[model samples]
Target chain A: MTRLIDVENLTLRFSTDEGMITAVDNVSFSLEAGEVMGLVGESGSGKSVTAKSLMKLNASNASYSDETKITLHLDDGPVNVMDLKTSKDMKVVRGGAISMIFQEPMASFAPAITIGDQMVEQLQIHTDMNSKQAREVSIEMLDRVGISDAAQRFKQYAFELSGGMRQRAMIAMALSTKPKLLIADEPTTALDVTIQAQVIDLMKDLVKEFGMGIIFITHDLGVIAQTADKVAVMYLGRLVEQGAVRDVIRNPAHPYTRGLLAALPQLDDLEKPLVPIPGDIPSPLERPPGCVFNTRCEEKVGDICSAKVPDFTNVTENHRAACHIYTQGSDK
Target chain B: MSDDVLISARDLSVHYPLAKGGLFGPKPVVKAVEGVNLDIAKGSFFGLVGESGSGKTTLGRACLKAAPITRGTVRYTDGDVDYSLTEIDNTQLKDYRTRSQLIFQDPYAALSPRMTVRDIIAEPLEVMGLTNGREETDERVREIAAKCRLNLEHLRRFPHAFSGGQRQRISIARALVSRPRFVVADESVAALDVSIQADVLNLLRDIQQEMGLTFLFISHDLSVVAHVCDHVAVMYLGRLVETAPTKDLFKAPRHPYTKALLSAIPSLDPDDPNKAQKLEGEIPSPTNPPPGCKFQTRCPFAVDKCRVDEPKLEHSSTDHVVACHRWQELME
Candidate 1:
């Protein structure tokens, strides 16, 4: 009930002009304090590069590899978020102990600032707040995210708000510095499914009033079965399964999570049909050497899922997966 | 009507105008398909749901006149073919653009990355002349790329070498290789992967019953338009609040903006989470909309005569219709 963020064999790579490309491959998982977790996949399946490598937010031809640890468990004790190493030690691991939110809240705001001056300049650059107590805690976190005239919608701007009020003013400027790990990534993929179900019931009421740890990312498996209390999945950039969102949405131990839940069309099933897991997911410079879903797997174990890389297998007691047809002697 | 109804519209509208106006600024326009009647019955599939400035891709490109019809009338017909998209010109709008096509919604910008999938599906029958040799356009682009499961040897490769459901089946084999007796598609599986969006919606409902064609589809995924539409319709800001038969709008969804968009859809039984009657704000600016039930600005039972009258879409039963103003007091 309180571990909050840890990762281990988390390898990553990039050196781009088409060379060492892996993007978060040996991924591991953990996150507890008010858990949410989900990651899901598709779209270069690295699930927003593992929630932007928990706040390092990759870029400049990213190439930091091997034993990629991360840690965190705070109360001023275990924080090595990959040994921070300056941007002023990643300002307490970005937004004061992690607070992401992305999939474009108008390209992460600043269309000439305003939403209460970009949430009082992100609570005066990560708190020790000033400017009238960061404009009274950014209009009380934009009236606790429902955002109605929250002090005149905090003086307006991100193109005068709406894409669900610029994602509830980017989740009230990433929960006005209340961060013990948030991440988000596809924050309701450019909204509008009733504003992505009111931003997933406002991130499940800001995870029951900020107990915090979310992670979330999404390629919408019904928004990771309604805001994931653990679920992992991803593909081409590996981490194959992980579980307990009702055991991977009711028993889905990877045939690419049962072809992404029989290619989901179930509003209580309308005479089922979307089977599609038949080929074509192979490119990040033609990756498929080993189960990056053995070229669209429909239970393929041939040449052991195109030559090895299976590992994980625990399959319940809160799931796990990876695949050579769920391992044990590899069904060969 | 077995003699296929290919296309229909009847009320249509496509608007646009306003580029930085002046002269007393009155004529501003941008309705983006306001009148909106529809038919598309021929080989039937029909869907169209909404949200994203709900014009459902400009009422599916103004029913293939490819936008800018601005107001009313369209007809098309098919067996013994008739026309009339309000005086079809420019060579019968280049012969109704080879019987109406579309398919778009970005397979990474609908493939023109230096063309290849055999010249982007034979550049729509070599720019609509249909097929004047290259062995009859490679035997009709190898029979619509093997009826879109694709792989007539991945047609000489390129769309950055496929995947996103094989470039949405090479954008549905270039909108069904000019055989198009009306197609539209628009958010063609809204950029794939929910298991390749139900395998490009069951390959557009098996190429609309194997090329007797018709389609339309557009989507904001109401459970993949209730398992691929047989008449759906919904839309919102630019009108048409209901229209049924997809199991009577998923069994009794008579428009309070189609039951808050089918209860803001996130139900895969995560212990029944859909508390969806959320809408209390945003979605107004269809250029200052919200006068008369264009969903009275985030409707929750909106009244005051629904902000001064304007509800008329009616027919609540046989073939559904709706448009609210208290959909009969939320259906009693």
Candidate 2:
């Protein structure tokens, strides 16, 4: 398998009125062609910020660390995403090699422009396609995404479509360019469960057909289990755990991951009461001194948990976690 | 009505008239909730599950008498009083407001930014004249806030100063301060992080148990409903398709819609083969719904009979109701 993207020591901060607040702490992960990686985290977990960093999509106030590096391996060559200083230079990563679909399809699409026109515009910008070719490709993509009457829907504005259809159209537009990597940011969160199922299946099929890597971001672990080949669990802007989907979910190494699993209401086991992780996620300004999850973790070992950040320790050949319990000499 | 029934609805419907479409032959009406029967047992946590446009929220509003009851009757009875929601007068409605309250979904928008947490929680008591004076209101506010796990310091801060989960606790504190007998939590935990969502859910459960309060928990997430609710009801296009004890409903769902819904939830076990019966097509528009079954368009087992004559709710088993023509055959 070809390596599609590699992110190393990515750290992000924003210059705010209050002061500089770190949105994404040191985080690293990679994806290969045809692989699906699920980025699971709650609000302020910085999952979105990390995804945005891949395309340099953060606002002007945002800044990245000097040690941060993002490399996209394209057929032509390897491009350093962090080195893209201009919007023109960032264009290749933004939509050509990487396409993103947002949670709210309504906000993503222009109310005035027809869906077809917007898709055609995206294609024209990303690929060497003419107006006529782009339109045909857009319609084909719409049909491929299971939108009925693709031509009619092509001419319809975003408002004319139902919530599910609008979401499908968004996926159609994102995949129309045939990018190497697709970043789906809670794409199914806003849709109904039934529609969410349809979208999830559609993405799985598209991945098989297009051989594109996908970074699926969602707070729902269930969705991740069904879609992602690998999973990365983040808390308070830090990547706390990463492993194959089965390993991470079945035998979560980190306390935060275990707490998250315990908190969820599982269908298979209805007798169990939900155990919420104690305390709240600290605000970015009050970011915890050491392990981000120490405040809420039930299995806190000692003062070391609040004194120093633990480095990643291997739980298995393919699974790893950042927590004192898993560290060698953290208790001392 | 049984003595245990806290709130009951018979043939309930809520329809909203749209503006005339250029001298239309007949004015269009959005049948937000139509021909429904429901019973919420006292001191029980009842879950209503549905997708958007399925009218779960509208049904909840109608039960609270917040939405106009266009037809049928909704009766609320406690040990002290019994009131029919359909024929409620201004005095009774005002009294009813003190007994029934709603917790909205978006914590960010639900809370008033200008009000301090203390004032926000105390407003309900002041509006209802439940407390004697400023001191009494403050005392009541502190009590409920403490129950919601909000500290004395939190009460002095504005909504902007707190995170989503803390703001939600404030809202919950506000709703409970008046000592309402019945509460409607409409997607209350949907906005919080997974860890915090669990905390709030546990708080809601604890509050319900301590107060001996009846709760109508409306959510799109099935897993959350499964764990928190004793009984669960599935709604589609403003109609009840199935209602059963949560255990029975999840273990052996009779209605095809309910079955599809349960299956659609992505399993946490990655090794489990996903045999989800993906329901195809979006929910039919309320204004132009199909004549017979609203879900027939997407139901895999929908037949000719399901297209011409609407099915009525019938007993699938003791205390379990299902409205599907082919449910029996499909179950076999």
The model with the greatest lDDT is 2
**Could you give candidate 1's per-residue lDDT for residues A234-305 as a string of tens digits?**
888888889888888888878887787887888777878778676657667668787778776767857878
Span of 10 residues, lowest total lDDT, candidate 1 chain B: B1-10
Largest TM-score belongs to which candidate? 2
Question: Model 2, stretches more than 4 Å misplaced?
Answer: A329-332, B1-3, B22-24
Chain B alone vs. reference chain B, TM-score for every model: 0.39, 0.97
Categorize the docking of model 1. Answer: acceptable
Candidate 2's docking class is high
lDDT of 2 at B54: 90
Query: What tens-digit string does per-residue lDDT give for candidate 2 at B83-145?
Result: 999888899989999999999999999999999999999998888898889999999988898
lDDT of 1 at B227: 89
lDDT of 2 at B57: 97
Q: Give the C-alpha lDDT of model 2.
A: 0.91
Reference-based lDDT, residue A252, model 1: 84
